[model samples]
Target: MLYTAYRKYITFFLILFIRLAAFSQGNAGGNTVQTVEIEPGKSINFKATSTPGSAYQWFKDGNPISGATSPTLNVSEPGEYKVLAQNNLNCTSEISDGFIVTVKTSVLVKQANLSVEKKSETKATSINDPYEYLITVKNSGPDPATEVIIKDILPEGLIFKNMTMALQGKFDYNAAARTLTWTIDKLNSADMSELRFVTEAVNPGSVVNTATVSATEADPDLSDNSSTDTKSITDLTIPNVFTPNGDGVNDRFEIKNLEFYKENEISIINRWGNSVYEKKDYQNLWDGTGLDEGTYFFVLKVKNATGTWQAYKGYITLLRSKTAQ
Candidate 1:
């Protein structure tokens, strides 16, 4: 009878031990359902809670995934996934709540081709003369462009006066930096816009103005992104007659627009080819002082900072009396 009682006690303890072990395994590691989103060409990694000396098994949609026994799984396709963990003593945990992955549609990029052209209304200009420049931006593409920007910086010897008009955008000019910027919200395919920029000539030389265009879309061609316009400037107006009779009107041997050329030399010769008067860096102040009333020859040489001296020979008839002969 004692032997039978001992055997019953052993069976009761065995059942209790099995129940405790099963409870411990259920609380070891598990998680709720998670949702993951990815693009068409993108992927995501699925991870499971890891325990020491534990093996893993993954399932997709209530089916066991073949050869997917790692703690982390690299998932590229959309599906519902679940994982289970087994300890060293062969105790298996409950299946996890798992994950729900959804693939998102891919978005295509916009492609566009932008070009710019700059041209001056006049090829030649004089100092302090106002001129106009036409800047055009064109877009040729299968898609529209956004946030279009055009930049045109005036070079030295040119001063920005103002913009005549802008077809489809706003322009801002910084006088101190000589920069003109235009911004457009959107530009449709096969469409074009223009800007008429007016400027004044400050110095005498070749003024090259370059304008460039850009947009928020991918550009296939870059060859026509920028355009350059060049202009030649000069101002040397010489007079043939002058009266140095102390009168305020026409009193000096003044050369119109000669002040624009800072480096210049002038010399006056008599009918006998004798040098009567000469001056360097002339300020148009020659009044034929201490000279007789007769016809004389004058030679004027002027040059800019980047050029050699250019000579202009002419005849000057000096008249001091109130009336001519």
Candidate 2:
């Protein structure tokens, strides 16, 4: 009986020692993570060495990342990432040292650059003239851009007419704000989106339009985000003098940029206030036929489909040389 009791005690002590050794090994060391740096759109995987039967919860910048319960972590954004491991025995280990990831600009893979540019179909415009503006967005990228948005601010000297585009996206114009906005879900690398809008040149001067572009991803270059276009304006250009001597050089009194206006009423009055000539839609066809050559007063009434009419009165000189054709 004494021999059997001693044997039982030895067995118990041996089991205790084994259990203690396993427990000590379970919590022996802390996790070690090396810092990493990667180019944009690149990911870095983190590895850890720690106790057995441990659970892991990953964090980014001290915020717990949901559904991240693995020994390895894949990180793309630049920030401080860490993991918390807890064993099944209910003993929690200290949070592992963080992995500081730096997302540097890519040299081989050119970073995304979203740019916008505007162009007018007509080089110059005049009041009451309708013209179209082509706004283009080009993406110079080794990476794609998502949630792209474009804002086009129209100048005050223009009246918005209409807009059109081929890309599948939501586009809107706020007349009160004089702003046009476009929202695209995604823009792939080397892709371009062209949108066109028509506007009437309202008041004269220099009409300037600007377009701005942005994306959800980080853009290495922002200098191309915005672009501008300027169009010269002339309300009306009428010659003050003309020599209608049949020389065909200065034979007719014509108005520049008058073809843009379809509706017009022109009247010519002599020095004695006599109505010498009058016509509708004057085609620059006046050759001073049967009219005395001298200084004359003229009145021009121009009308546009937009329900706008402007009147211009000025002095015009009609000189006829002594040698007539």
Winning candidate number (lDDT): 1
TM-score of each: 0.45, 0.44
Per candidate, the number of residue pairs that clash is 0, 0
Over the stretch 1-325, how does candidate 2's per-residue lDDT look in tens digits? 7545443343333223222332222222234444567887888666553434257778898999999987667778988786665556554445655557888875554356899888876533457777788888888977888888999878776888987554656889999998899888888899988888788887876788788999877788898899888775667777778888877787898888789888998999998889989999989888888888789888888885566776667778888884544
Clashing pairs in 1: none
Worst 10 residues of 1 by lDDT: 21-30
Give lDDT: candidate 2, residue 324.
Answer: 43
Runs of candidate 1 exceeding 4 Å displacement: 1-31, 36-42, 47-56, 85-93, 102-126, 129-132, 146-186, 194-198, 205-325
Full-model lDDT for every candidate:
0.77, 0.74
Residue 170, model 1, lDDT? 88
